[model samples]
Target: MTTVLIVASNVPAQPAVLTEALERFKGRGARVAVACFFDAAELEIDPALAEIRSFAVPKEQIDKRLRTALGRAPANRKIWLHAQRSGWLMKWARTADLLVAIDPRSVHTVWEMAQRNVAASACYGLVPALRALDAGVSAPVTTRLERQVSATAARGVRGARRAAISSAKTTLRKATGQKVMGTPAGAWLWTRAVSAPKIPDRYRSKLAARVHDSAVRAGRHAEAARAATAAVSRITNAATRAELLTKAAQSELAVGRVPERLHDAISAQLTLADSLLRKDRKRAATALSNAWSLASNRVLHFDRLSSPLVDDPAGYLAPFRASEAARLLSAPRGRSVPAAPVPSGRPLRILLATLINDNFLHEIRQRYEAMPNVEVRFLDLDDDPARRSLARSGSSVIEHKLAGHTPYGEKIEEWLRPHLDWADTVFIDWCQATAALFTMPDPGDTRIVIRLHSFEAFNFWPHLVDFSRVDDVVFVSDHLRDLSTAVLPQLLGAEAPRLWVIDNAMDLQRYARPKPAQARFNLGMVGVGSVAKDPRWTIEVLRHLRRQDERYQLLLIGSDLNAKTSVAAKQYADLLKRDLAELEPSGAVQRRGQTDDVPAALAEVGVIVSSSVRESFHCGLVEGAASGAVPVVRDWPYFAGGAHGARTLFPADWVVDSPAQAAERILAATATEEDWRRSGQAAAEHTLKTWDWTVTQTAFDRLFLTD
Candidate 1:
């Protein structure tokens, strides 16, 4: 068997690409294994594949150590530390038949690994991996010192520019913090304490902590805050007040102390979050967490001001409730003034459309688009800047998320109705604002269908869906349906319309690849960027495997954690990065970053793991399974206990909890190379037979094509 080992960075797109290759290779008895750092549990794999395990290297632990070291070290030494660690990473190199990198950031590590693993052919992207495999030879490509110098210089230029910008931000934040919190009394203590030279670095943080506490205890919060601000302000530090405030808030909350100037804390953190979000939106999630912690503070609810939710639900929630963010979370509905028959003109020009994610509508659109029976117009909410409303919530752009959709929502209805009036049916994707807006009123004679994905259940959009106008609600999974029903009982109310669970339209025919000789050893996961897509758990599995044998390593795809965006995000990112750092250099895990192709990445991944806490339908895992990667599922804690979840989505043998169980399964499957190859072929067949778009599109056709 020509064995293929995919070194992925846990990108979400990996599964789809892999599934395609598995189909082609399986009939030929090729072996495949996917080794990655992120979780792929959400991807419900076909049971035919061998059991999959995660080769995760907990980068968070090393990152934490690095952060601790950085916190203690002089700023000049950070780069030196990173360079010194390259020597520490050589042990994890893989001698796979093929190596594919899923992201750009991971290219460096992959390049290093390829240098030592001369038997392995390395390439970026699933397509590239496939090409390398087709070449059937491992050619050693070397990077000379001159080339490294050029690359380093280019990177230095980029880093220099980034550092300059970061310095400016830091300076501004420190200045703001000093102005906002500095007090003469507290300043006296800080000035003397900070100026003391040659004090042990270890004691520095503790000393600073003592001074801060003294100021707080003395009822000089502003003074204490200002002191820290002053210390940080002048150094062109990127860490700003919002970051400080969050740290302060976290400490206070942990000890159960609320900031005296709660409003100041909230606003300061929010403003900082806004600024950070302007640059990097992902980090804004933490800003929301921080804001929530503050707003949900007892003082705001009971200690002082009356909650807007309690006082005036309509007016208070106006900012949030009226936002496109909230609207996207709801079901679709039409107005009370509805009953109109299709006019006796041209054939019903049904307009089946959605905002952007048309996963469910692909087949339905094609069917209707080809229906000689209708006229069609598909609108992506993101296509028009005016219509897109979901920005990072509460980042300075919150006002935008709130204010941005009102007119646009109306314009949508205006632009859409004419087509609705012209045609008969109008299908919208996601129960998001697109659905809400389309159903804002009666669509003269048009029938409307709105699909509900998993996330919209946790949010507010389902509450806004005017059931009065909606004709159908489509769901991808049953657990989502059950949870959504409980979350929004309005569906059980008089206005509720028809709701159905339709599988997503995925063309999974490509899986069915031959396994390589060492296909039994690798474990893979797809997607690792979000908190929801937890990669840490996968690390635990790898840890388990190393205890048995150190042959396993994880591969992560996607951007590294960016905590600089918000305190909450930073905290989480910091933790995750720490986990990655420890695991990465040890060769226990590899993070590749984001990529477009998956089949090539899957070429090397023998096993696939899903590690999400929650999900709608983890298309990634299913795609991985289709690619013939042994699918190991986490049972999906978010949707596990529900009626429809990972259990119902995939065969029972595939699901498990904890990394130990995952390791046990991987060990058993890899016990023999022959055992591994058969399992992979079976999985590829299952994915191709079950989830291919040809099969799923039928469900779509039934949902949209039916009267």
Candidate 2:
């Protein structure tokens, strides 16, 4: 068998690339041996490749002399020294017909081996080695004395060139080292050099980053910021300027510090996006998307107790409003024809569409499917990989808008035009990617309706939607409608789609189960998986109640907060862990986790609390009320003191402004067994009469059946 040996100084950056090369080599009847300087466990090799063998250099097995030599050698030369002492690798190298270096650090080791194993074909990189194999190995030809002398001269010249380049790199490193950057004069000198005229944009950006990093490491953050800003100001290339500033901002955010030039960085990206819109739409989309990501980072918004978007919506969004590219995204594309009237003779064809999230559609779907005069069809873009990709390609949507027409736009038309032709109306569940995609192509005479839930109002998806193509916009509550209109503003224009506030459809009757007497002091909360839910606020309320009466305990439902979402989320989760650790072992806080049998779970809860920072209409709290639990709703800070909010959505007595107020309400409502039961019964009756599916379906009927 033809033996092939591959050497890597470190773990392969792209294992799939190495795997494909190995498989190709095996197909050619080659027995491969891979030698890695690092541990073998870091790379997961397929056991099925039994013909291939791998060896990891065991540091413990090396003698003191070799280990000391390895520690002192440069990174690349150390690989060569390690291989020279590895008996198993040396044995394979002697017999191998082909030698390959998978990475740059291994190239030097392979080159040294090639001088000893002159008969074997050697190459740097997998592709060059593969090409060498394809050319077939041959015996070395004899050379004259003159040719040998000439080859020696060429090697000496190349070695000298490499030495010169290494010396230059050493000098550059010293010039911008942390010790030098610690001084004000050194920092100022390097900053000026980076911003000097005629420096290549690529080189200037890289140098500016190095200087900034060195200054920051030397405890000169202000100097680092000034250096980056100065360098960016000199960069005439829009893409390069935006990229450098964005990197600076991201580096700050990664270290848990907000960037001083955060707004400037966003503005640079938006300017780049606008400049590239017509010439290169894809690039423009990328720049715009990056701008949005930086602006809406969790550190700036959700992870904190307050958000700039909430505290100062107009001021925070001023950058987006000023961007021409953002304007193009929201630019109205009016429909060619108004929606056709509901079918007179045949059934009205209704299409319900969403991407993966079908939690809110079960009731509406069942209601329409059971009706004889309606033909219902459901489209989940996620069901098909190709369709899902098209639906979620926000960049492609932006590109199509800028270029006026693109293959992506045509693909959207091809995929959705047939559904539009078949359906008299399409109801898109969330104002997200699905909504934006549906509006990409004109719906012809098919009416388009989209629902804006609480979260979508804070996301970029709503901004991508073209409201002129939609006939109606639905909100679950009046507070949500008010917030949505304030955020979009276009919704209030004369040409904007008709807005409606329809309560969410829910079957609340199933929750009317008998509660045991002990349940009167147990509090319940559902859906604590997001930062907005603010489970910590609920914990605070629990603390207040327990101070007065030790009988009160909290039953936390739903999944735990996902800390992996963002740094702010992780900080919040850490604080929550500390709270749980204090109360959980004492049996004061009980975690029931997630359960499908929510109504049964409600049987143990006497009071339901909504301690959210914001909510459109809290479905879980209402469901608890239907189960004969007194409701205590926080004013939902996102809309408090507005035209409509939690106070207007629920009864005035049920809403509270603070944890102490919530505790007082809970105590008064549950003063005695008779009073508690009577209060829960009253709340249950109010919720059942107002928000149940039986009561809300009529409004849906009027929406779909009449119009």
Candidate 3:
């Protein structure tokens, strides 16, 4: 019989692995013990494996001062102090035949003990430790000495680099710290030296570095950092101080670049991230984002990557898999207990939820509000003034989702936890915010249903959801489901929720209006802002039509591409503008900025064109077809080989693989206005019969009703 002990940090998914290891060992007459400094939440052990005892000293008992002091101490000293004080660890360690350090932070303490106890085997992970305990191969003593020597050499190298950096930083700090510029006389002297016209870029950077070094020597980090930052800025050569500092910080963050002295890189990045965030600049936000990537730990050198927490909530956060934070984020569903034999039904309760999009909810709410058994409520997280202010400013954004878990995640959970407790079923709309908030797992026994549309699949939100609590995942199309499952591995976990495919709810009855005869030769496109839309191809098809007959005109709808979002977007907008410039004045094309009257917009489009590379459903094109426009869809390259997308959404003849093919279809349809009207009439009937809200509402009903 063997006993194994596992010591770990409060990482995401610890309990599941712990339980599995115990189960594997139980067959071999092995007993396991577990320990943690932080709460475990994301996973739980089976009752059979619950015999494993894990120890923890209350976080409140630890002193912040001591923690800080320990952080600055020598490596061996830190381990010695920690082991001596953490008696729970020592007590548990004494009984174990095999000891495992579940995280890097816990590895040192285990190593320290292994030096004193030669009979026990030590491993880095649960799997390795369990294997060692089962096989019964104990660690050798002289081999331990060799391991210690190698570890000491590695630590020495890191210490030397950190020492060199500390020395240089001190020198720079003193040079820049002086209040020299604060005095008029000193400012004048500094101004003359910096403003020297003939000083080449190389010389200027050298002088700036010297000045910065002087500021550091004077004991002023603020002044030194400032002088260094300023000198780097003033040197005209791109390779000067300013460029060098940024490069130095970035290069130092490269994998294994400066693990020991990496604090400065993180500090520089945060300084820049905060500055950009304060000023509300998007470009600076991107630069800071790159800085964060380089600063991340590749494997185990630094802190474990947050990507795992965001990507695979259950598996990655296993250590914290069953804590209040983890449970609140990932609620485990209990087996059905047959609803306590209802003698008499009082009323039905319905919870209405839309994360950021409240589009179809108005009608859904209206229907439920009139029912005696149903209660309707609406919550918009973005409506909060603080969040709104952040979105409007778009500054210092915390690199999308890494920033997601902080202010946004906490505020959302606080607001939604109560609602989740009471509602029998919560319908979370739009997989972005809705899925993310509900996935935090405080279900309070309420059933969770998340609806996935097109864009959410491409983003980081779905990855943030804790699937343990989600009762049902609703996808708009099979193609979206396929893509989402392919990109996210956690969705396939044992606890993953059942999935349902339902079309988007659109009131197509409004688009059952009449169309003008001239629309027969017109090609209309709605929402051309994204590069994924590939509107340029639509223009090619239009040009081909015009060569055969000038009667064909294209109508473009929606606001132009936004320059604020990205440089690539701005560049694409420029090229689009040039294309529009030639076509608009020639009466070959028309631009309608934005309008609330969609039925009216569809009226002028006899031939609706969907030119996107991918789409979950393409609601606009369907609406246009219902308005009597013949639909022509690009094969939708993103899902061309997948199970379903634009091709399956529309009729077989309606989908075209290329611009040339689209032009061919247009030419045949508009051979005569009479012929075009007949073809469009058939398309309108098929669209209304197949994809209208009347039909889609049934699909949604079945999904919500099925357990």
Greater TM-score among 2 and 3 belongs to 2
lDDT for every model?
0.60, 0.86, 0.63
Candidate 1 C-alpha lDDT tens digits along 1-707: 66555444555565665667555545445566554445546444543442233444345656776766556555444433342354322333443555555666455556655554556667777667666666664543453344445556766785799689779856644433444224664457564564366654334433444455555645456666655544433323233445454455544433335554444445554554555555644354355446545645442322221233333334433433333333333434345455344435665555656666665666566766776656677777667675465311223222223333454445556655566666566667777656655655466646777778875654444554566677778888888788767655556666687888877777676654555665566777778655566677888888898888888877665566444433344445667778777888877787767777776677678888888777788888888888877888888776656567888888777888778888887777767777777677777777777778877777765664556
Candidate 3 at residue 502, lDDT? 78
Give lDDT tens digits, candidate 3, residues 319-374: 22222221222233333321221113554455777645787566566655776655
Q: Considering summed lDDT, which 10 consecutive residues are worst modelled in model 2?
A: 47-56
> What global local distance difference test value does model 1 have?
0.60
After superposition, which runs of candidate 2 have C-alpha atoms over 4 Å from their true positions? 1-204, 207-236, 255-259
Residue lDDT tens for model 2, 193-300? 888898899989988887877776687789889889889988888888888888878766655456778888899999999888778778898999898878877766
- Backbone clash total for model 1 is 93
Best model number under TM-score: 2
Worst 10 residues of 1 by lDDT: 299-308
The true-versus-predicted C-alpha distance at residue 192 of model 3, in Å, is 33
lDDT of 1 at 322: 31
Counted clashes in each candidate structure: 93, 0, 42
